[model samples]
Target: AVAFCESVQPLEAVVSLMAQRLALAEDVARYKWNQKVEIEDSAREQMIITKLKAQAVAEGLPEAWSETFFKAQIAASKATQKQLFAEWQQHHAAAFEGVPDLNSQTRPKLYALMSELITALHQAWQPLQQPECQPVVDKLVREKLAKPGYKVAGEPLFAVH
Candidate 1:
């Protein structure tokens, strides 16, 4: 994950720089055109500045905030997974209601499968943020895996069914 963050850092930097340059160019063009700086022009320029600054801030945000974003995303994904897992548990239990034992191993495995999906999602989405979320994401992944029955496979944690 750290390696991935490092790799994306340069890409994000380039993207930010390009965006800033574009904003600056637009401003310069407008100024050069000198079409009478009216209220509308001021508003437009303000909008551009806002956008550029947002991009810059996103690119330059502290690593901790990026981590929080990652963790929050992970938490959201996990919550969804947990919900699906519960639904699976109910349906499967009902399906084999009369059965003595309907694959005890599958339940836990399903949970773990969902966890793995979220982990992969985090890895894939982490780069979307200008800053890196690797450190927090990595820690959060481990913390999630530590949960009991998370490693076991059972009903398939995802709703792919």
Candidate 2:
């Protein structure tokens, strides 16, 4: 099981990055709200997906599977943003002051995280298919994953099933 755990380490890192990105979404949502911008930017999302697909191919991971995993990350981030926005609105929260520029401050950080995630995915791809991977991932997620002020719902992005 040591090898199994080692193999899934990269996958765990990817998930940890996802969690970090979700935490960043709170800042993103606040920035968007302050700027009067919509949270769902299809064009930007498509661009990211396209870029990730190409990167995945270059890194020896299947493009389709990589895209699916990336879509999950995008979906999770958006869900977190939506939930945060709703809560803020419900509370009649005051507008956030001096929000950082999304393009310069936020997107750059997210982009860096994406790069790390892609690298991790490439490292984990084959080992992720091992029979022991699922249970080990479950254990690690339960024991080691940080709670980043949001729930991680939906399917495990890299799990076999």
Candidate 3:
């Protein structure tokens, strides 16, 4: 959905996808919690980042830059999940109802969105490297990923070298 969404700028589309990905953390956390799964999955995270870095190379984008951006998204997602877990714990909440399976459903969706995000980011790569893009990217990030735990490092993420 994020990938096909019409936008004036590819960079804006990037932010939208990032926001969409972050938003999915809720369902992910719920499913994980309901299934008694751990919040941190370092192995899977590394695998994903590594895979994306390789893809970034193929796309003519800087690997570290791409990793940084995705890492920020992961961090924000984890933060939101952790916060949700804490709240659920304090409230002694029951398992979430109607959450999608992480493997069969959620992950496939996330991968699709990630693919689109990569394409959008590649399209916006040149402009994103400009110094002037920092403020604009930061502003968009703030507006799109506005939730408290969803906030990322903002302007600092645009420096791709």
Candidate 4:
């Protein structure tokens, strides 16, 4: 019989971190809106992917899986930013004051979250291969994320399922 811990799952923590990371999009969108910068930063996204891919091995994650995962996350983040931008535009929103500096404040928080994610993904690697993975992923995305873009980000964790 499966142990109690085996029956339980830690995927919620992963989805929570994903939601937290996506939440940063509002601050990013505000900063971009004020600075007149495009939401899509190909160079920065590539750099993040490259850096994370390098660290994936050390974190006990497959490089290719990490690439796909982070790419999905970047896409989700960009989608959220664009949605906010469109909403603000429709309302003729004024320049938002008190926006946190994207460089120092927002990026640091993202980096810390990424660090935590690396650790969690390492722990979830085996569990992600189980047949139960798809249902858990669907449920967690529905509960924790509950956003259209997030549905794309939260997909089959491994090819096994």
Candidate 5:
């Protein structure tokens, strides 16, 4: 009987016990109480947590730094990716609409824009693909490089030669 009851009991029932003491109705109160508990715990630990965070940075801890750097890079990459994709979309749309090719006089400007975009793609994708970030960045690069007209080589992504 005990085993049967324990097996059938929802986890929430156990969690809801303390909340019932606070004059809150069971279901709604449980959620509100849990949120308050979480907020209170976070608030109480804020100072210690902040100190630990600072220590992590001051220590130059590789794993922590890698995690934080990856997060920042992810944000930057997303922004850059959006901009690059937008430009690609714009150029593609224009081409589809029969935009005229640049005259010889304007060819340099078109080439410059194209070069800048390629450089942007490299900058955004390369860092993310470094050994530290390989798992995530490699996937993105693979996906992007799969598109027609995109070229990828097995050599180093950057210049050391």
Candidate 6:
């Protein structure tokens, strides 16, 4: 089952990145709200997806698989942002102070996470095809609940089967 564990390792990285991205979304929502910018940036999202597709091709990963994984991450981030904004609106919250620049600060960090995720995917891609992959991933996620603030959003991409 070493291969199973190896396959699931990348998924753990993906989950870690997802949690971090969700946390970052709070700051992003604050900045957007204060700046009168919309939370949903379709152009930016598409640009990132396009970049991911190209990177996937370069890395020998299936473009469709990588795109689907990245799309899930984007969806989760947007959902968190929307929820935070709605909560702020309900409370009539004041503008956040010392908000960071989205393009310069936030996006760079997200890009780094994306790079790490891609590397992990490249490492785990073949092992993910093993029959034991899904069960091992599920177990790891369950084990992760012992850590505070650890969460699994939806299912791991390789766990679909």
In order, what lDDT does every prediction score? 0.34, 0.73, 0.78, 0.79, 0.30, 0.70
- Model 5's number of clashes is 0
* Per-prediction TM-score to the true structure, in the order listed: 0.24, 0.83, 0.87, 0.90, 0.24, 0.80
Candidate No. with top TM-score: 4
Q: List the residue pairs that clash in candidate 1.
A: 106-153, 106-154, 106-155, 107-154, 108-152, 109-152, 109-153, 109-154, 110-154, 110-157
Better of 3 and 4 by TM-score: 4
Clashing pairs in 5: none
lDDT of 4 at 76: 84
Candidate 1 lDDT over residue span 23-107, tens digit each:
2222322332233222123454344344433443455543343333323333433333354445545765322222222125422
- Residue 114 in candidate 1, Cα distance off native in Å: 18
Q: Which pairs clash in the backbone of model 4? A: none
Winning candidate number (lDDT): 4
Give Cα distance to truth, residue 122, candidate 6, Å: 1.2
Which of 4 and 6 is ahead in lDDT? 4
Identify the superior model by lDDT, candidate 2 or candidate 5.
2
The segments of candidate 4 whose C-alpha lies over 4 angstroms from its true place after superposition are 1-9, 156-161
Give the per-residue Cα lDDT of candidate 1 at 90: 70
1-161 per-residue lDDT for model 2 (tens digits): 25444476676776677677766877899998887789999999999999878987888877777777777677777887888788888998888987878999999998888888878866776666776676766665555443333235225453543
Cα lDDT, model 3, residue 69? 74
Off by over 4 Å in 5: 1-97, 104-110, 114-129, 151-161
Query: How many backbone clashes does every candidate have?
Result: 10, 0, 0, 0, 0, 0
> 54-138, model 5: which lDDT tens digit per residue?
5444443333432343232223323333444455457653222322332333234423432332333323443433444433333
- Name the regions of candidate 3 deviating beyond 4 angstroms: 1-8, 153-156
lDDT of 4 by residue, 1-161 (tens): 54322533567778888889888888998999999899998998898889988887787787878888888888888889988998999999999999999999998888788778878777777667766565676677878764657866776353532
Expressed as tens digits, the lDDT of each residue in 46-137 for candidate 3 is 99889887887888777777788778777888888898999999999999889998999888877777778888888877667666666677
Worst lDDT window (10 residues) for model 3? 1-10
**What does candidate 5 score on TM?**
0.24
